[model samples]
Target: MFYQFPEDFYWGGASSALQTEGSDSSRGKTIFDVFYNLAPNRFFDGVGPNKLADFYHRYKEDISLYKAVGHNSHRTSISWARLIPDGDGDVDQEAVVYYHEVIDEFKRQGVTLIMNLMHFDMPAALQAKGGFENREVVDAYVRYAKICFELFGDKVKLWATFNEPIVTPEGGYLYDFHYPNVVDFKRAVQVSYNMIIAHAAAVKVFHQVVDGGEICTILNITPIYPRSDNPKDVAAARIADLIFVRSFLDPVLLGQWNAELVEFLGEHDLLPVGLPEDKQLIAANRVDFIGLNYYQPRRVKAKEHVPHPESVLLPESFFDYYEMQGRRMNTSRGWEIYPKAIYDMLMTIKNEYGNVKCYIAENGMGIQQEDQFRGADGVIDDTYRIAFYKEHLRYVHQAISEGVNCFGYHIWTPIDNWSMINAYKNRYGVIEFNPQTGERKLKRSGSWFKELVDANGFDD
Candidate 1:
């Protein structure tokens, strides 16, 4: 092996319950279901989150695929709607049994199970009263977290409170890309603050209940860069980083919000009113580790003009997105392919933060029109995906060698599953899923990943 990892380094892939598991009818409705039902046209191909990859009925087969891929650890989330149905009500006994069976099967296969409490799938009942904007919803979420720790904490050692906590506010509140789409900057800030508090509450409960279990939250960290060395551009990038990256990162890791962020929010009159004990809870319950989902870097320049007084306020109002000329891009998914960003992110966490333990929670390429790559043997020859992983892993390996405390690397997913809004437009999985026939086939990247995991690394 050209670059070997530590003996116990985790090698696996990730999935979310709402994206993979089907049987939506049995599970209670989520805010996503309500949103899709209200506006099915908003989704690509008019496909909502119904009967996704059917992981609910096919988890045993999926676990077999994980074993075949040489995965020692797997990251997935539990569906709150499936588990508790109404979000704050009696537990669904069937859902509990199913999760236990799934955990036991992973243990039998020698795969470490990493379970997440939430992944952008809040129950519809909770969202009816303003989702995270309502303090009652925060208490409901804490209750759900407690139930999870009590029920399955023994089987799952690694638990994440949430996945990409920023997405909830950004997509739903600001961008109108998710459920209960509301375009309000103040609500966005409130949602962000409430989520941080909820995460702290979950961490506190995890510590109180789960013995010998580690708790963390997953963040999609994208280092922002200025278009030039100009001070204004640099400042724009800095502010963007504060809003997107450090807003949640600082609070979860350091147990306090960033000073600059607080000042900025206060200046704009967007600061959320903290609960009496919110500060103390956040200060007391910090995470044991972090899970970084890095894909691209954000390049920004100073805004060309000031926004009108009546214009909607946003972090982007102070900065303009700049696309670097001649940079490589994944045209299929319309995202920049910057492998070094992972190295930069890991280094930032090490230097700026306290060098906390971390892992590559979700990182992979999503390609459209993948069927064209199928060869005569009927196998998808996704060599581009292989190259993508190799490039990113090289940077990840560099960071690990530099003492970044990054212990694991998991791809975005093990199988192609349904994505929100985009539906099944882009596929980011080692195993190809045939939606027409419900069959699974290992792509070339799957075979390559198996080899990479088995050897711990690959030769140049």
Candidate 2:
């Protein structure tokens, strides 16, 4: 092996409740359920979350497959709606029993579990009441976190407050990709600020109730690059970074908002209001670690045209996406594949964020119509996916050699599951699932990953 990892390094994959577990009607409906009903055309092929990978009933089989693939650790999220049917009320006894069974199964397989308290699956009951935009929703989220801590924290040592906290506000409020499809900049800022507070509150509760458990949040950190060395372009990239990365990164990791971010929001009159104690709350409850979900880097240039003063403010208003001439791209998703961005991200964390403990929570390539890769031997020959993992893992190994405290690297998913807007169009799984028959087959990437895990690394 060219690049051996630490003996205790985590080797596994990640999945969320809504994406994998197929039990929507049994539990409380989420905003996703509501949105899909309202406009089924928005989703790919009109496939909703009603019936996903069926992990709810097939967790035992899934864990066996995970063990076969040499996964020493696994990450998954507990559905807020499933645990508490009404979003904020008495715990559902059935849900409690189900989760305990799942935890026990993982323990039976000797797989270390990293559980997230909330993914993007917010309960519709909460969404009906303005979701994160309302401060009351923060209290509701804290309550949910407390219940999770009291119930499952003893078994799950590693807990995440939320997964990609920025996506909620960015997609739902600003870009209209998620529920409540609003395009209000002020509401988006308010939602983002409230989510930070909610995360801090969850961390605070975790500390108060949980014993010997480490809590953190997963952030999708896409390093921003200037299109050119021009001063305006550089400034645009900086502003874009502040808006996308530092807005949540600073408060969670550094326990304070960046001065530049605050100034920019103030200048545009887009600051979230209320709770002078919010800063102290955030500072007092920093994460024990961080999770980086690196997929691609952002390339930005100065905006060619400024928006009218009366136009609503947005992060893209300060910068424009710059497409480089000869960049490697993922044709299925149209996302640039820059492996070095992982190294740069880790170096930034090491130099700027005090070298805090972190891990690659999610990273993988999603391809459309992957059935063509199957061979005569009944295996999917996903050599490109193998190469993608190798390239990214090389950078991860490089960062680790340089003393970055990254401990794990989990792929985006363990099995092909339903995506948000794309539905099941793109497959990012090591194991391929037959949507029609619910059949499972380990792909070539899965076999290769098993060898990599057993060897602790791979030869170049």
Q: What is the C-alpha lDDT profile of model 1 across 1-460, one tens digit per residue?
A: 4978888999999999999988556799998899888999999899888858899999999999988877999999999999999999999999999999999999998999999999999999999988999989999999999999999987788999999999999999999899888989899999999999999999999999999999999999798999999999999999999999999999998999899999988898999977788889999999999999988889999999888988888878889999999999999999999999999999999999999999999999999999999999999999999999999999999998999999999998899999999988999989999877889989999999999998999876
Weakest lDDT window of 10 consecutive positions for candidate 2: 20-29
Deviating ranges (above 4 Å) for candidate 2: none
**Model 2: colliding residue pairs:** none
Q: Any idea what lDDT model 1 has?
A: 0.92
> Looking at model 2, how many pairs of residues clash?
0
Q: How many clashes does each candidate structure show, in the order listed? A: 0, 0
- C-alpha RMSD for every candidate: 0.9, 1.0
On the 0 to 100 scale, the lDDT of residue 395 in model 2 is: 96
